[model samples]
Target: MNQKKTIILDLTGCKYFDELHERIRIAFDFPKGYGKNWDAFWDFMRTECDAEMVEIVGESTMPKEFLPQLELMHTVLSDLKIENAKYGWNFDYKIIS
Candidate 1:
């Protein structure tokens, strides 16, 4: 049987963008020089990772000040899904509050 890979990123105590980025880089094992920015994030999600699904949890506990960043993450993932479909890659991303 083939099993799809699932990666979970728990962002429970992340209060800042940098902290969130660092945690994601470590959790996802991003490359040594992974750029910690939205653009780089999209690029990595689109090209580097090979997961069938990615789950981001604890968003409700994130600082209100980081809402924009959270929203951007969601948007980027949505865009990536659309782009992936066009290229015949099955990818899915989810945010959990």
Candidate 2:
């Protein structure tokens, strides 16, 4: 499945970037608790945001949004439902065929 793309919100003077980063980091790592669980992504956004600040992006399969919660690293990531199927790093290099 394709990963969900994110919308960048330029918080030029926002002072909550670090807190937001921690929140998102916890969520992404422990999706069930602090991460973007399928059941709770929209729920949290709806409750925690105003009507204009949050808008759902991406396809139905991977819906993302612009969260004005305050952070640069707290962007969207693809959801893999399986608990054990964690996302890992990628290493790519050019190889002429």
Candidate 3:
């Protein structure tokens, strides 16, 4: 079976980590009261997410402070892919300008 690719991460006008998390929650249709943190992100992605590709927009324009979190997100997604290897599950992202 083939799943349609989805771009759930776009930081075009995002200027803060909280804003980014809200975008993520909205994009992924996360339920209310969702924890807007890395652990929450990892748990959701590992157990419930089905999006194949999460395109990250505005890489160049993101605030300097956002870079650290962005890198952490990349790491989390990468780790998610690895941990789900047993199920042959895959996740990927692309940074767009």
Candidate 4:
């Protein structure tokens, strides 16, 4: 039997829809008219890796009344929402064999 205790943090200060949207926009660099690409968005959602799951953990204070922000983060990170490789394109990934 193994027991582990984990402490989670939300440093994005996402406490409302606006904050969440801003975070999403900045995090994923969504176009100004991203709403027009719902199909592409949905397709990416169906096939993508999670950002957090494959990268470093950020520090954020979980703000109350930030359901929208939280949901956006979760959605974008999971394959059910967006593509990870495309999301963090600015970062360079080096493969070691």
Candidate 5:
């Protein structure tokens, strides 16, 4: 059985964009000079980060004002999923409320 790496992002206390970005960057150990933006996030997810699966928790607790940012994250994760599938690698994202 191949066990894939899993990283969980608990958003229980995340409130702002910067906070969310910092938490994710630090959790995944993204390289230095990681721009805290959607484009950079997509790049990292698609080519830099190494985890086979990522789980984001506490979505229901996230601030409503951050909906757009959350959507962007979902989009990036979806793209990564597709990219990984093409390479015969497993990459997945899940959200738990």
Candidate 6:
């Protein structure tokens, strides 16, 4: 079996939702024309991303206004986990302090 790969994304430098999305795209090595939006993120993660685990770091440094977006991102990841399980694709994610 192939070894699992873990990916960590630090949000310390992100001041806006766009930056957060950009970080995700870069970390996942998404396509060059990746759409920087929540829907697009969900689509790519469910269909293309191969990371066994994804960790979110340095979130406290991000802007307060981005709280909603942050919450929704977690929601997306959680939902993806369920779908992955059904397909026999193991995956997990977490936010770290």
Q: Any idea what lDDT model 4 has? A: 0.38
- Residue 24's C-alpha lDDT in candidate 1? 81
Candidate 2 C-alpha lDDT tens digits along 1-97: 8443332333332244344343433433333354434235434443432222222221222213424331122232222122113443221111111
List model 1 lDDT by residue over 24-95, tens digit each.
888778987889998988888877888888899898998899888888888988898898899898889887
- CA error at residue 23 for candidate 5, angstroms: 0.9
The order by descending lDDT is 6, 5, 1, 3, 4, 2
Task: Tell me the tens digit of each residue's lDDT in model 4 across 3-94.
Answer: 32222322444455554444444444455554423344444334432233222123244455554544544553453323445665321221
Taken over the whole model, the C-alpha lDDT of each candidate is 0.86, 0.31, 0.79, 0.38, 0.86, 0.88
| Ten-residue stretch with the least lDDT total in model 2 | 88-97
Q: TM-score winner between 1 and 4, please give it.
A: 1
- Model 3 scores a C-alpha lDDT of 0.79
Instruction: Give the Å error, residue 55, model 5.
Output: 0.6
Q: Which residue ranges in model 4 land beyond 4 Å of their true spot?
A: 1-11, 36-60, 68-76, 79-97
State, as a TM-score between 0 and 1, how close model 5 is to the true structure.
0.91
Error of 3 at 81 (Å): 1.6
Model 6 C-alpha lDDT per residue in residues 33-93, reported as the tens digit of each score: 8999989999999788989899899888887888899888999999999999998988999
> What CA root-mean-square deviation does each model show from the true structure?
1.1, 14.3, 1.7, 11.3, 1.2, 1.3
Provide the TM-score for each candidate, comma-separated: 0.92, 0.22, 0.86, 0.39, 0.91, 0.92
Candidate whose lDDT is highest: 6
- How well is each residue in 1-97 modelled by candidate 5, as lDDT tens digits? 9888999988886898998888788878887688989899888877777898898988788889989989988998998899889989888989877
Give a tens-digit lDDT track for model 3, residues 5-97. 686576787887788889888888787677999999888777668887787777777878777898898899788767767678666777767
